[model samples]
Target: MDTLELQAKAKELRQEIIKMITAAGSGHPGGSLSAADILTVLYFDKMNLRPEEPDWTGRDYFVLSKGHAAPAQYAALALRGYFPVEELNGLRKLHSRLQGHPVSSKVPGIDVSTGSLGQGVSVACGLAKGLKIDKLPNHVYTMLGDGECQEGQVWEALMFAAHYQLDNLTVIIDHNRLQIDGQVEKVMNIEPLDKKLDAFGFNVLLVNGHDIEAIQNAIDKAKTCQGRPTAIIANTIKGRGVSFMENQAGWHGTAPKPEEAEQALQELA
Candidate 1:
C-alpha cells in the first residue's frame, strides 16, 4: 500500500479504536491510537501474511508486547480482512473473542498473547530463535511500550536476543512518553534509550511512529540487519489523532463516553 492509503487507514483505525473503547465502556485508547500507524504499516505493507490462513507456517510473526494496545491490532486485523469488521463491536464483550487484552487462540491473527509488560518480547526472541533453528527465513516482530521498558524482563530478553545473534527479530518501542501512572521519564527515566538498547546489542533505529513510510523502511532495514536484533524507537503522541486525548495521561486507560467518542470521531474525520 502507498503512503496515502496507509494514512487514510490509520485515521480509520484511530476512529475504530475510539469506538471499541466506547462500546466496551473500558479500554486503553491512548496507546491504541498511538500505535495505529505502526500496526498499519506492519499489516498493510511490511509483514508477509495470509489473512485467510492465519496459521500459515510461512508467515512472519507479530507479537503485541504492549497488549493493552490490542484494539489497534484488532482494528488492523479486521480492516486487513482477517475477520469481519463488525466483530469489532464485540470487543470486550463477555463472550467475544475481542477481549480487553488479546487472546491468541481467540483471535486468529494474534501470534503471542500478551498483557504482561515484558513477557512478549522474550516470546518473540524465542520464536525468532526457533524459526532460525528450523532454517525458516521468516521474521518476528514485537512492539513494547516505553513504560514497559522499565520491566527487568525486557532487558533480559534483549540481552538474550543479542547473545544468540537473532537478527530475524525486530522490537519496536512505542515511545509515546506517557504511561498509566504519569509521564514515562518522570515515572522512571529510560532516557538515552538508544544507547541502552545498543548496549544490549540491538541495532537501534529511531523514526516517527506516525510516519507509515518510515516504519515500512525501518522494517526493511531490520530484515537485512545481520547478527543482531533491531529496535525501532517510534516517537509518538500518547493519544495521537484525537484532539482531546493527544499526550494526555488521563486517557491512558479511560474509555470515552459516547459524546466524547463522537467528538473524537469528528476530530479524526
Candidate 2:
C-alpha cells in the first residue's frame, strides 16, 4: 500500500477498534487506538506474512507485548485476511478466539500469547535468537507500552536482547504517555527513554507513531543495523483519531457508549 492507502487502512483499523470495543462493552481502546498506525504499517506494509498460512516457517513474527491493545492487532489481522473480519465482533466474548488478550493457539496471526506485562519481549527475543540459530532470515518484532516499561522484567528482556545481539529483533514502544491510572510520567516515569534504550545497546530510532512514512523508514533502517536489536520509540497519542478520547486516560479500558461510538466513527470517517 502507498502512503495514502496505509493511512486509510489505519483509519479503518481505528474504526473497527471502536466498533469492537463498543460491541463487546469492554476493551483497552485508548492504547489500541494509539497503536493503530504502528500496527497498520507493520502488518500491512513491513512484515513478511502469509494470512492463509499462519504457521509458515519462513514468515516474520509480531508480538503485542502490550496485549491489552489486542483490538488493534485483531483489526490488523482481520484486514490482512488471517480470519474473517466479522469475527472481530466476538472480542472478549466467551468461547471466542478474539479474546481480551491474544492467544497464540487460538488466533491466526499472533505467535505469542500475551497479557502479562514484560513477558512478550522476552518471547520475541527468544524467537529472534532461535531464528538466528536456525540461520533463518526472518525477523521478530514486538510492541511494548510506555507504561509497561515500569516493569523490571522489561529491562531484563532488553538486556538479554542486547547480550544476544539479536539484530533481527525490533522493539516498537508505543509511547502514548498515558496508562489506565493516569499519565505514565505521573504514575512512574520512564523519561529519557531513548537514551536509556541506547544505553541498553539498542539501535534506537524515534519517530511520530502516526506517520506512516516515518515508521516505515525507521523499520527499514532497523534492518540495516548490525549486531544489536533496534528499538523504535513511537511517540503517539492515546485514544488517537477520536475527538473525545484522544489523550484521555479514562478511555484506556473503558468501552464507548453507542452514541460515543457513533461520534468516534464519524471523526474517523
Candidate 3:
C-alpha cells in the first residue's frame, strides 16, 4: 500500500477502535488509540498475513504484548478481513469472542492469548524459537508497553532472543511514557531503554510510533539485521488521536462517555 492509503486506513482503524470501545462501555481506549498507527502499518503494509488462513504457516506472526490494547489489533484484523468488521461492536460483551484481551483459541486472527503484560514477549520468543527449529523463515513481531517492561520476565526473554541470535524476531516498545498508574518514569522507570536493549545485543531503532514511513523503514531494517533480535522503541502519546485523551493517564483504563466518544469520533473524522 502507498503511504497515503496506509494513513487513510489507519484513520479508519482509529475510528473503528473508538466505536468499538464506545459500544463496549469499558475498554482500554488510551493505549488502543496510541498504538493504532503501528498496528495498521504492520497488518496492512508491513506484514505478510493471510486472513483466510489464520494459521497459515508461511505468514508473519504478530503478538501484542500489551494486550490491553487488543482493540487496536482487532481494528487491524477486521480491516484485513480476519473477521467481520461488525463484530467490533461486540467487544467486551459476555461470551463474545472479542473479549477485552485477545484469546487465540477464540479469536481467529490472534496468534497467542495475551493479557498478562510481560508474558507475551516470552510467548513471541517461543514462537520464534519454534520456527527456527522447524527451519521456517517467517518473522515474529511483538509489541510491548513501556510499563510492561517492569516485569523481569521481559528482560529474560530479551536475553534469550539475543543469545539465540533470533534475527527473525522483532520487538516494538510502545514507549508512550504512561501506564495505568501514572507516568512510566514515576511508576517504574525503563528509560535509557534503547541503550539498555543495545547493550543486551539488540539492533535497537528509535522512531515516532505514529510515523508510517519511519515504522516501515524500521521493519525493513529489522529484517536484514544479523546476529541479534531487533527492538524498535516507538515513542508515542498515551491517547494519540483524541484531543482530550492525549498524554492523559486518566484515560488509561477508562472508557469514554457517550458524548466523549462522539467527540472522539468526530476528531478522527
Candidate 4:
C-alpha cells in the first residue's frame, strides 16, 4: 500500500481500537494506538499472510509479545479478513475469544499465546530456529513493549537468537516510553536500547513508529540482513492519535469513556 493508503488504514484501525476498548470498558489503548501504523504496514504491505487459510504452515508468523496491545492486532486481523470485523464487538465479553489478551488457540491468526511479556519473544526465537532447521523461508516477527525489555528473559532470548544467527526473526520494540506503571525510563531504564541490542548482535534499526514508510523500509532491510537477528526500535508516543490521549500515561490501560470515544472518533474522522 502507498503512504496515503496506509495512513487512511491506520486512522480506521485507531478508530476501531477505541471503539472496541470503549465497548469492553478496559484495554491497553495507549500501546494499541501506538502500534497501529506498524501493524498496518505489516499486515497490509509486508507480511505474507494467508487470511483465507489461517492455518497455512508456510505463512509468516507474528507474535504480540506485548499482548495487552491485542486490540490493535485484532483490528488489523479483522481488517485483513482473518475474521469478521463484527466480532470486534465481542471483545472482552464473557466467553469471548477476544479476551483481554490474545489467546492463540482461540484466535485464527495468532501464532502464540502471549500474556507473560518476555516469553513471547522466546517463542519467536524457537519458531525462527525451527524454521531455519527445516529450511523454511517463513520469517518470525514479534512486537515487544519498551517496558517489557526490563525482563531479564528478553535479553536471554536475544542472546539465543544472536548465537544461532536467526536472521529470520525480526523483533519490533514499541518504544512508547510509558508502561502501565509510569514512564519506562523512570520505572526501569532500558535506554541505549540500540547499543544493548547491537551488543547482543542484532541488526538494530530505529524508526519513528508512526511513520509507515520508515517502518516498512526497516522491515524490508530486516528481511535482507544476514547472520544476525534484527531489532526495529520504534520510537513512539504512549498514547497516539487522539488529542487528549496522546502521550498520556494514564491512557495506558484505561478505556475511553463514551464521550471520550466519541471525541476520538471525530478526531480520526
Better of 3 and 4 by lDDT: 4
lDDT of each: 0.94, 0.96, 0.93, 0.94
Runs with alpha carbons beyond 4 Å of true place in candidate 2: none
Error of 1 at 206 (Å): 0.6
All candidates: TM-score: 0.99, 0.99, 0.99, 0.99
lDDT of 1 by residue, 1-269 (tens): 68999999999899889998899999999999999999999999989999999999999999999999999999999999999999999999999999888898889999888998999999999999999899899989999999999999999999999999999999999999999889999999999899999888999999999988889899999999999999999999999998899999999999999999999999999
Error of 4 at 26 (Å): 0.7
lDDT of 3 by residue, 37-134 (tens): 89988999888889999988889999999999999999999989999999999999998999889999999889899999999999999999999999
Q: After superposition, which runs of candidate 1 have C-alpha atoms over 4 Å from their true positions?
A: none
Can you write out model 2's per-residue Cα lDDT over 174-234, one digit (the tens) per residue?
9999988899999999999999999999999999999999999999999999999999999
Candidate 4's error at 138, in angstroms? 0.4
Q: Give candidate 2's whole-model lDDT.
A: 0.96
lDDT of candidate 4 vs native?
0.94
What TM-score would candidate 3 get against the native?
Answer: 0.99
Full candidate order by lDDT, most accurate first? 2, 4, 1, 3
